[model samples]
Target chain A: MNIALKEIVKNKVRFSILGSIILLVSLLTFIISGLANGLSQDNASLIKDLPSGQLYMNKEAEGTYNLSRIDPDIQEKINSQQKEAVAFSIQMGFLNDESGKQRSVAFVTSTESKLFQKVKPGEIVLDRSLEEEGIKVGDTLTHDQFSGKLVVKSFVDQKKFSHAPVAYISMENYKEIYRTEDMQLVFVPTAESSLLFKDLQSFSNRDFLKTIPSYSAEQTSLNMIIWFLVVISGMLFGIFFYMMNVQKIGLFGILKAIGLKTSDLFKMMWTQMLFITLSALALSITFSQLFTSLAPKDIPFILTIETTLQLAAVFLIIGFIGATLSGIQMKRVEPLQAIQQGEV
Target chain B: MLTMDNVRKTYVVGDVKEEILKGISMSLHEGEITALVGPSGSGKSTLLTIAAGLQRASDGHVLFEGENMTTMRPEQVRNIRASKFGFVFQFAHLVPFLTVEEQLILMLDVSASKMKKNETKQEINKVLQLVGIEHRKDAYPSSLSGGEKQRVAIARAIIHKPKVLFADEPTASLDSKKSNEVMSLIRDLTKTLKMTTLIVTHDEDMLRYADHIIKMSDGKIL
Candidate 1:
C-alpha cells in the first residue's frame, strides 16, 4: 500500500536513467515483436481475410490448384450438396514487365472472386512496386523468364511470398497463359459433398496451403529466428537485473540495517525495471512505425498488437525472475557485518 | 525502555569464525542520551545494530518493553523498527535526491496510518522547524553544509517520533565545530521529544553531551 511512486519521481536522475534503459529494452522488444508479426501477416495477410471459412482443392494437387488435378465433375459434385462453390485456380510464373525482371507469386485466377476481375487477358496485374521498378500499365512482361509476353494491366494489393509479389487474374485468362488442360479446379464449403465429386481431392485454403511444402518449410525457418531473439533477449534482461542487484550488496546491507525490508526494497527495484520496459516498448513501436512508413508495403512487413504484448511480456517476466534472484541475495547481508565493517 | 543483555556477534570468513561483539549489555531509560565511544574495529556500531534489532546477536538478548527483541521474527522486528525506533548515520544517508521536506515525508509514508495527508505535512514541517532547518526545507542534501545536513538527518529520525533513536557516528564526517553543533541539536531534540537516544562514535569530544557514557573496547563495554 505504501508504494513510493513519489520517491521515484523525486530521484529524477536515477528514475530517468532506469526509465531510459527500460525504454530502450522495450523498443528492442517491440521491434523484434513487430518484425515477427509483420512476417506472419505478410505471409498470409490477404488469405487470412478470405470470406470463405475454408478452401477446397483437388486431393492430388498438394492443397493448391497449381499442383491439383481438377475435374469439373468433382467441382459440380461438391456444389450440389450445399452452398454455392467458387471455382478458383492459381499458379506461379514470371511476368517480365518493361524492366525485364522476373517476379513471382501464385497468381490467383477466380471468375467468382473480385480479386481476379481486375486483370484482363494478356495483361498483368502486379504489385505497385512494379510501377516504381519501371514497369507500368503499358509495359510488356515476359512470363517465366521470357517464356511469353503479357501486358501490364493495373496494380492491386501486394501480397508477398519469399519476397515475391502476388497478382490476381481471371481463371480463363490464367488457363490461357499457362496453357494447361486441367480447368476443373474449384473452391467449395467445408461440409458439402456430392457423388459427382467422387474421385476428387477437396481441401480448404488453410489445409490447401499446408499441402505446399514451401509454406511449411518457410514458416519453420522464420519462426526459429523470431523465437531465438525473444528467448535470448529475455535471458539477457534477467541477467542484467540480477547483476545490478548483486553489485549493490553494500547499499542493500545499509538499507536492511536501517529497516528497509527485503520485500519493500525489491518491489522498488522491480518497479524501476517495469518503468524501463514500458518506455522502451513505446519508443520501439514508435521507431518501428517510422520504419514501416519509409518502406514499401511489398517488404513483407506486418506489425500487430499481439506480437508487442507477447514480446513485452517476455521481457517483464524475465526481468521479474531476475529481480527475485537478486532479492534473495539481500538475505545474505547481515546488518551486524555492515555496521562493524563500515561497508555501506 | 530498551536493554541489551550480554549480546555478541560473530562472522565466518571462509572456514574461520571471527567474533565481534563479546557479551555486550545495557539499558536505556527515557530522556537519556548515551554515547558508545570506541576506537575503530571496537564493534561499537555492531553493538548498536544488535540493540536496534537491525542485526541478530550471536549470543544473548535485546529486550524492549520486557519482550525479547533478539528472538522476534524479522517482520516483527521490522515493524517495531519502523514504528518504535529511528536512525541517523555518518553519511547523512538522505536518499541523495530528495528535498529536506520530501525526505522527512518518507519517514511517515511507510507507516499504515490513515492520518490525512495534511496532518502528515504538518508533522513534517514541525520536525523541520524544531531542527532549525525549516528555512532550508526546499533544499537537497547535496546543497547543504555538513552541519545543516546533520540537522536534517536529526529531523528525519525524530519525525516518526520513535521511542528509540539510534545514531551510528552521527557527526563522524563533520568538523569539530559542526560536530558539536550537530551533537547539541541531537541532545536538544532528545530532551524536547522525551525519547531515548544512543549514538556510537569514535570522537571522544562528543561525550560531554551524553547523559550516560559507555566506553567500548574490542566489543566490550568498559
Candidate 2:
C-alpha cells in the first residue's frame, strides 16, 4: 500500500495549496530566466554568434573595445600566422534614409574571412531588424562623413551589437568613413594559444564581451536575481517541509512504533516532494515556453529548452536536500514520548 | 510466550542517574492478559515499550519464543515487532490519511506478509468484522467516532496474526461504556486468537479483564 499517495489523495486541499505555491514560484523563475537570456542575446549576439577564439586589441586601450586600435604590422603578422584570422572594427553610428530618418547601427568592417559578411565598396549588409522598420534591399543609405551613397546589399538575421542592428560595410568604405587606417581588433577563430606580441593583449570571446560597456553590469544583476529565486524556492521547500514534519512527528512516532521502516517514512517524504516539484515544473515550463513565443516583439524573452532543463534539475536537487534535512526528526523520534502525548 | 529477565532502564539527567525499571523480571503466557498497574511515575509504560521493542532496555534479556532479543540489532528487533508483536497506544493513532481497510492493509505490509492480494483483502475484512467495524472499512480516521477509531486500531493491531499484543491505555480517550466495550473486545480477541497480551493501565475498572494482574510501584513488582 502506498500510504504516501493515499495521504496526498485524502488531503487534496492541503497538498494543492503547496502545489500552487510551488507552481507560482517556478513560473516566476522561468519567466525571469527567459528575460535574462533575451537581454543577453539582444546585447551581444554579434560576438556570441562567432566561433570560439581569441580577440586581440591594443593594451593601451584600457579594456575599451572602441578605444582599442591594433598596429597595422601586428595585425598583418597575426593574420598571416593564424588560419581564419580576421581584423575587424566596430563603430556605433547612424544611417540617413531617403526621408532623412536617422537609424542607429553598429558599423562593422572585417578583412577577408568566411565568418563575417563580405561586401564590396559602396554596398552594405544590414541586420534584419532594420528591414522590419521599413528599409528594403537596394535602398540607398548615406553617412554624413562619406561622399558616396551606399546601397543595401542584403539582410542577415540576429546580427546585433551593443543593442543595435549591425551594418557590415567594406573595409575601404570603413576606413574612408571613419578616417582611420588601423583596425580596432583582431580575431583568430579557434586559436588555442594567444599570439606573443608587444603592446597587445588577447581576450577570450567571453572576456572580450565584458569590455563592452554595460554588458557585464546588466547580466550580473539579472543573473543574481535568477539565482536568488532558485535559492528562495529551495528555502521555501525547506521551511514548508519542516513545518509539515513538525506537525507529523507524533504520527511518525506511532508509525515507527507499529514497525514502519524509517526508510519508508523517508520514501514517503521524497515521493511527495517529487510529485509537487515535477507538477509545478511541468506547468511552469509550458507557460514559459508559451511566453517565449507569444511575448511582444519588443520584449526579448528567450527561454530555451536547455536552460529550463538545467534550472529544473537544480530545483529537484535542492528540494530533495530540503526535504531530507527536515526528515531528520523522523529518525530521532521515540515511540514512548509520542504514546504518552496522547492523540495525534 | 514472552519473558523479560532483569530488564533495567536508567536515564541520566544532568548529573543524576535515575533508574526507571530496576532489575525487573516477568513472563507473559499465551492466551493470557497481564495488566501492569501503577501510579504516574512507576515506569509501567517504559516496561511495556521495552517489551514491545519500541525502545531498548538498558540491560537484561528479552526472550521471545526462546530467542534473546536484547542482543539483536535494531532492525532485527523491528522485524520481530512488525511480525510477532502488535501494539495499541493510549490513543488510537490510526493513520489519518488511510481508510479503515487501508490501515489494516498497511499493517500487513509492515509485517511483510506473504499472503496473496486476495488473501490479504480477505484477512483485512475478517479482522475488520471481528472488531465490529467492517461497515466503516472505507472511512478515514478523521470521520470515525472515538470508539470506532479504537476498534479500527485493534483490527490493525491483529491483522497479521501477531503472537503478542501490547496495549498501553488503549481506551484512555473513550467514555465509561465505550471503555468497557473496548476491554470486552480485547479480552474476547485475546482468547479467540490465543495471543499473549500485556496491558498497562491506571484505571481500576480495567483490572477486572486481566487474567494475571501485576501491581507495580517505583519500577518494582509489588
lDDT of 2 by residue, A253-315 (tens): 888888888999999999999998999889988988888889999887889999999999988
List the candidate 2 regions with Cα displacement exceeding 4 Å: A193-195
lDDT per residue (tens digit) for residues B1-222 in model 2: 899999999999999999999889999999999999999989999899899988889999889999998888999998998999999877898888898998888899999999999999888888888999999989989899999999998998999999999999998899999999999999999999999999999999999999999989998989
Q: What are the candidates' individual DockQ scores? A: 0.28, 0.85
lDDT digits (tens) for residues B1-222 of candidate 1: 998888889988999998899888789989999988888888987788778887789899899989998889989998888778888888666655468987777667654445678898888878888888999989978789878888887887888788999999988889998899889988998898999999998888899999999988887888
TM-scores, all models, native as reference: 0.76, 0.98
TM-score, prediction 1: 0.76
- Predicted model with the maximum TM-score: 2
- Lowest-scoring 10 consecutive residues by lDDT in candidate 1 chain B? B106-115
For candidate 2, what TM-score does chain B get against the true chain B? 0.98
lDDT of 1 at A186: 62
State the lDDT of candidate 1 residue by residue for A32-138, as single tens digits.
55555566555655454455544555666544555666676666565566455666655656665555566666676654544344566666677665666666776
